[model samples]
Target: MAGWMNLVNEWLVPALVLSSLAAHLVVVVLAAVRRREASGWPRAILWLANQAADLAATQTLGNLFLGSTSREKHLVAFWVSFLLIHMGRPDNISAYSMEDSVLSARSVIEAIFQIAGAIYVLIKHIIIGGGGGGDGRTFVLASITMFLVGIVKYAERIGALWLGDLGSIQSSGKKLKRASLSVGHLEISDDEQALQAAHRLLHITKGAFADYSSDEVEHKSSHANDEQARLAAARRLLHIARGTFADGNDNGSRWSWSQGWEQLFRLVEMELSLMYDVLYTKAAVIHTWHGYCIRFASLHFTAIAFWLFSLSSKDGYRWSDVYITYLLLIVTFLLEVRWLLSALASTWTYAFLINTNSGLRHAALCSGRWRRLRRFVMSLDLCRLALVRDPSSYRMWSGKIGQYNLLSECTHDMTSFYRTLAQRFGSEDSWKEYKYCYSGVLHISSPVRNILFNNIWDKLKLAYKPEEMRAMAAMPVPHDNDARRRNKLDKALRFAPELQDYILTYHLATDIFLQCSGQKGAACAFVKTIEVLSNYMLFLSVVRPYMLPGLKIHSLYTATRDALHDIW
Candidate 1:
């Protein structure tokens, strides 16, 4: 057992060191790929890598601190710096979710320890080992160069995380001022224009999600006569519409909407994409002058370090370790190059270039060279070209909502499964309730989209005043829906005070109504829409309770499930 332990320790450092690099590669490749994918597997892998990448590197650094006499000291010291660099994930993914960002304090402490550990490893292996000759000096120089770059990269990560944290943002207490969103007849004919437009409105969406209220007094009129003009109007309308999500009084009174549901959906989807970047990615930190400067500095230092390492002596190091070191250097350079290219082609960068009164604006926008460069970058969209049959295009969120049918689940019987597992955990009622709450997802159809759009539009038309609009928000359904229906709805609302209870009550009622009124032709479409929405609301209550107000009582859902089952 002692011999086995020794053997395990002997190979663990090299294995973990290489695993760190492999995890970095996995994270970068998977982060891009996962955006286009809706499956659980790609996201699962990406989340695992996002978590394990830092752990593997940190563990490897800790093992190096134990001191190895077999490996060359200079090579080990160089590897330590690379580990520090690896701690800063690629800009494509800074945090997997907002919860990760909320732990900013813990991250700061962890980063401090990791950085200190790397510095200690450098001191132990290089400065303490003594610079013996020309090769020794070169190695020390390379290590120091990488050490500076590593620190910069780590600082960027922590800053990005801090900027994303809700507590940090709320504590700042800065009021949001509306930007002058005057595009002045700028039509979105191409992807470049659309991207720039999205970038321009990115802040509005970010503020809306963060519960920041914006003050805009000017009311802009949109005379959208054609398709391009309508799209342009829709873009500006997004700025006003964002207030509704933030619970602000502004319900798009500032701008008139002339576009259809399709254009509105597209605009909302783009804003959601931007929101993802702001919250999860490094868009909060990058897309600034300093971000650009530090990125280029990191790139240059990496190139110089690679050159210095290559020029230094490799006589004492193992051939495999030397090759692995070279591999890390080359991969790091290539990843930085990829990030640079992507940033250049990004809409955020485009908005910065055109909006700013700098020479770069001319070089990037007016010059033919930058246009061609951006065009080239667009052609190399890694996520789009990854899978030929990938269905999602130019959309961020999967345009699908989950569906959990209480009535449907209650009807299905699993006798074999019931015999084996029904009473294993709890009572039969509990098992049945648990099974009933499992959800399935379905894409929103054109009819359902139209129904939703028309309903909201009708409500908006009715509410001319801001107070009226606010009052209407509490009434999800039309008050004038036949007298009997209204009476039934009011009665149901009396018993269901919590939002979750109300949703379940309405969902069950809607399911029963649909079952009874199985009308054909046009009425069938209405029935289907009702069914979809009812199931969707139930799905949200079960699966994503945080999105809705009020706490979700599992017992309520369980009791409802059992009652519905008994009735059937």
Candidate 2:
């Protein structure tokens, strides 16, 4: 019975060990192929090292179970040195090298250690006989120690792989977002141009969506329509603005663009909201996968460890039992390492999601503020029209004016709200805080500011009353030199052939407001407000002439010329 048992141990066990090692190598190779693009060199190195250890473990186990031949023992010792060389090292930062000199040096050192260990194992086995009993306690203790060391090494490798995956996902997401934003810049400036640009962007965005969706088929398809609708709405607004301007009814035409602009802005906000949702969903999926990997690895290691421990107890303290226990421990270590890596990957995914969500929120708030400002301008247009149609309709006109004033106040409140939110939720030093928190982007661009001022100027230029026109003209130019202010007045006159009389009226009205308020700055603010109105009128005048049938390049040029000449 003992002879039969020895034969089973010597032949059967070695063959099984060799087969397991081969399986591990195949699996590692497959995984490497699948993850090559995203996997860093460090991860690859660790994986290769693990495979080497498995190879060593197989050889060592075979030698112990078979008749502990000196050559076989020496081979096992060499593998130990190989494993030690990798295990003793700290992580390498750079993955790619023509030759890993450190690893090479360690390999040589391991060879020497392996020769020594092999000789020791061979001599002991020959003297005591292959089946000689040893202290079971020492063998069991050594097996356990080896098992733990293997586990630690495997855990480190797995952790590195998980973190690398997280980094790759984050980079892809950021690249997509940047592409979207680049497309967004097309929405700025003139209606027709902006519409065409937005349409092109929408097409590009859809293509990207299709590519990404192919990889993540589980994602809902609802967002596609939302993005399409947004682009369409923005284009519609541009068409309306062009139509209204061409009709020559400034107030009514402006109203068309205002409503369309509001719709388009809302759509943009919705698009941003959808982006946050998609990112969050992707993050959840990544986390789920990571958890699954951890659980699977843990179960695998636990089963192997339990099986080995059970057999070792039955066999008593023999070299073969010690070798089997060592193999089981190494397996357990590998699983534990995989779990650690999965956890780290999940953490990085969470960070990326949070960062993107915050950016989208900031964009939404900024769009909301712009929408409110549009409504305020529309209200003012209605009030002016009511007053002009019926001089005795003071009550009706006053109500409209009051509504307009309220809307203006609402816009200010919205600005304050955004400022508070930025301070609370965003990093103080981030670009979002700098651009949107205090309207820094709006402040820095003199050309855009001039455009806004021009729009406001257009409204003031249409004042029916001489006194009102005088009050507007008297409004100060905040940063304009005397020459610049005069130039603007000249430009306004060029757009509105009737503005020369209007300017005299505005100057008189300005004196009246100045006397009523002791504060000169208050008087200046009111004057600057009128200048803003003139700028708006200039914009309308330029846009209006181009709205006619048989639109020509000359017509466009004339409109711009009139506005620029008037402002200059």
Candidate 3:
């Protein structure tokens, strides 16, 4: 046993130390070669220095174990090796040129302790004379110091891991909160407003659907049967109109704000899922990179463990050496576990991307189905309108002519005012003046008109005053001497309220649909339709005197004067 121990101590330990040094040198050389094309030379110098230190340490360890008469040489080599280890430490190495005072202080303290320990080991080695002659107490103290250093290094690694986890959790929570707020604030109320908006939306939707449907039908008809294409087109339009009306219901209605929020949240979630899928794909790539790092680290750790084991086993392994081997094994185990987790994460991320892509495709299909249904409803409505001979035949048609007459008178008054203004002013200047006048009249009269005739009566309740705020309101509103002509206008401006409302609703609905179709030409057509409708209403008003009852010419004249004044 003593002979075997002597052979291990004198030969095996020194050989193993040399092998470890050679391996380290090879690694440093490879690192240098790989980084040769790097922008800077400092990294290459550092790696070269590390390799030199490793070689020195290997030589010193081998010579010390072999009882070489070169204490100064061993000490110098040991110091160099220690310095290299300290430099490799994450906290000890700074990316910038500026030294970190706290890290420097810690390093100095560590170096002091290491130097003291090295001195004690040297003294014990000198007394041993090639035999393990140190007192157990000295060995224990040395082991304790080494253990403490390992603990510090491990604690630092753990802290970094915890901090990363905390940051990820915080970021995830903030994203969720933002998504929640976006959904919470997207509610709409006021049925009248909703109905008006819906009508407008419907008009736009119908117009867009019609144009697209016509084109699609023409294309289909040219290739196939025209009758079938026409039928399909009609069905598509009707479906679109119905869907638009259904979708336009305000949140306050049966659909509710909660439902809208739920839908929007679902959309956001779906979008997030897609984003996550992309991130997952990226993470997979990152994981692959990390895997390579893990494999490299594992190889180094394995080499270190084997080398340490070889030395300790040869030199009559002490408790300290055994503990270090265990620690190295622990490090290797951790690296293996981390590598496994990274690989799993990469696999999971790839699966997630695939699933998300499928889900997105499904969502697109659902959207297309919904749009098709909406188009079908619109086509049905259009067909019904086409079949009707008189506007009065429709359910929304009002037989009363008083409203029409009233509107007609109002139109005529506006035209006459425009004509007079144009004659008095140059055509170019008059046109500008007319636009401003119309814009102002529309802006002011819109609220009043909406309140008096539409469902905005409740909103105007606070605006009503006992002649106190009336002055203020009156100040904002332009006055006209034609107020006395109200009786004459009431009789002249008669029209069917239901019919007018229906026409306006249809027009608005068509416009809304057109906007949704994402067609620029359809949008232009909708705008043109609105302008034409406004002009037609004005023309009808101009001819009010020849139309129905309840429209007073005098009252309409007063309203026109006020409208023009408000416009200006």
Candidate 4:
């Protein structure tokens, strides 16, 4: 038993260090997968890797503190610095979801503890040790430099989380003032144009919807042609319209519609893609001034430490430990370089360059050479093309909506037991997962998309004012005095005051109609359209209550489910 314990202890720290490195590699490699519509396995793997990164690093640090088996204290101390760097996480990711940003306080506490542990490890293993080879001062300085770099990175992550928090977002909605320069004369590809436009219009989603105005907030450039500005404005308006709806803060909003349906659809997709970046990724941190500072500092300190370590004596350390140290240093340097390059080539940086004047730096960045270089870097598609063979197959969104039917759920019950268990003992997320497990998705066909767009477009054309847009949510049934005398729909409408009630009622009615129609009109595409729209409405009410207005829709769904089960 003692021999087994010894063996485990001997191999554990190195194994954990390597595991942590592997996890970091996974994170960096999969960094381009920012869309929620990406495969669930990649997301799941990324999530696990994110969790394992800190776990492996923290555990290894603990092991080192508890007296590691290695005799090379200096090498072990150097490994401690690398562990700290690992804990800071990669630049491309910070939160896996919105919930993570909200729980930034927890992350802060965890970072404090880890930083304390790292400092303790450094103090014990390097600062107090006296047996290393010639001129240990430079080695100690190198370790200290790497430690400072780790702290800066960790701070950057914490700041990112705080910046992305919902409360912070709500409070600082007016802080992001419009830039002075609009992007112009850039001979770029379609994807690059979309990225540039998204970055330009990001402020609409990032801040209060009430603050947006085309003339007041839009960045205008004297060099930009009038036709170009008009086209960009049209695209921006479409993006803002969807952004306002997705944000859900504004009760009523009006946006000018000039773009075609295709452009409008693509604009919505790009807007959502941008929202994902702001809410879930490190875009909030890496696009700002301080973000640039931290990236430069990280690269600078890493290079300095590498040089210092190489110049310092390593006679006393084991060859294996020395090789591992070199590996860690080289990897850190390369990652920092990659992150810096990514930031420089980003659309945000392009926007920044167009906006700012930094003397020689401004001239260099604005030059045609810099534009060509940026174009070249973007053409590599390092994040997307490397991971996915066919770029066309990859999209920011899957362009499918969840399909659910209240009657179908009531009739074919499968997850009732699991859902009950979840409600009784599990978290809110568990309950949601089980309750909605049976829901499927359907691609919105092109004809259906056109019909939906035309209906909304017709309504918007009539709704000149914001209040009229808000009123458009109501069922605009043309009041036929004769039909009103014949039917009791007024009473039915009163009974279904809540959106949930209306959704369920429509869903049941549609299901009944479809069942009765059978093969009679099944050949018609409109039949499928009716079924699809009904299921989608039910899906919104059941699986994604927050997307709808008002509160307690989940409770309403639960009550409906119970009543249906009892009737059954």
Q: Each candidate's lDDT (Cα)?
A: 0.64, 0.36, 0.33, 0.63
Ranking by lDDT: 1, 4, 2, 3
lDDT (Cα, tens digit) per residue for candidate 1, span 8-117: 97667667778888888788878765444433456768877777768877777777688763336567667776677677888888877666676646767888888888
Kindly list the per-residue Cα lDDT of model 4 for residues 1-568, writing each as its tens digit: 9999987975677678778888888988776554543234566678888888788887877776887434466677678777776666787777766567765467678888888888887877777773355668888788889989987787777777787665666456535544532322221134445555556555554432222342232322222222232233344444344434321224432234554344445555565566555656677889778888888998999999999989988787778777888888899999998888778876667766655666645665746656776666656776666655543225345556777777767776646676667667876554543344323446788777777777655543432233433343242542232123212322322323376677777787778877886832375667767877888877767766544543446777778877887787
- lDDT, residue 503, candidate 1: 90
lDDT: worst 10-residue window of model 1 = 218-227
Candidate 4 TM-score versus the reference: 0.75
Specify the highest-lDDT model's number.
Answer: 1
Where does candidate 3 stray beyond 4 Å?
A: 1-285, 289-318, 346-348, 351-568
Model 2 TM-score relative to the real fold: 0.21
For model 3, give the 10-residue run with minimal summed lDDT. 92-101
Tens digits of lDDT, candidate 2, 1-568: 9999978855554454444454444443333232222123444544564455446543663455454444223223223322432332222211121122123446556544544444444345433333334433333333334433444443433333323232332334434543342321223343333333333333233323332211122222222232243333333332222222322332322222243333343333333222222221222332344444544554454455455444533332446635654564565455445434433333222333324557643553445642354334435446445645421122110110000111122234334665567567864333232332222211213443445535543532432223432343355742222223334444543534444334334433554454476543343544545444433333222222222212233344345335544544
Q: Of 2 and 3, which scores higher on TM-score?
A: 2
Which structure is stronger by lDDT: 1 or 3? 1
Tens-place lDDT per residue, model 3, 75-193, is 22222222223222222121111112113456556545544444444443532322343443333333333333333333332332222222232333333322221111222243222
Off by over 4 Å in 4: 31-34, 66-70, 103-110, 130-135, 174-191, 209-258, 307-320, 360-366, 386-395, 413-439, 465-497, 519-523, 551-568
What TM-scores do the predictions have?
Answer: 0.79, 0.21, 0.19, 0.75
Q: How accurate locally is residue 475 in candidate 3, as Cα lDDT from 0 to 100? A: 47
Model 1 regions lying over 4 Å from their true place:
1-3, 32-39, 68-73, 170-194, 216-239, 242-257, 386-395, 413-439, 464-499, 516-524, 550-553, 566-568
Pick the winner on TM-score between candidates 3 and 4: 4
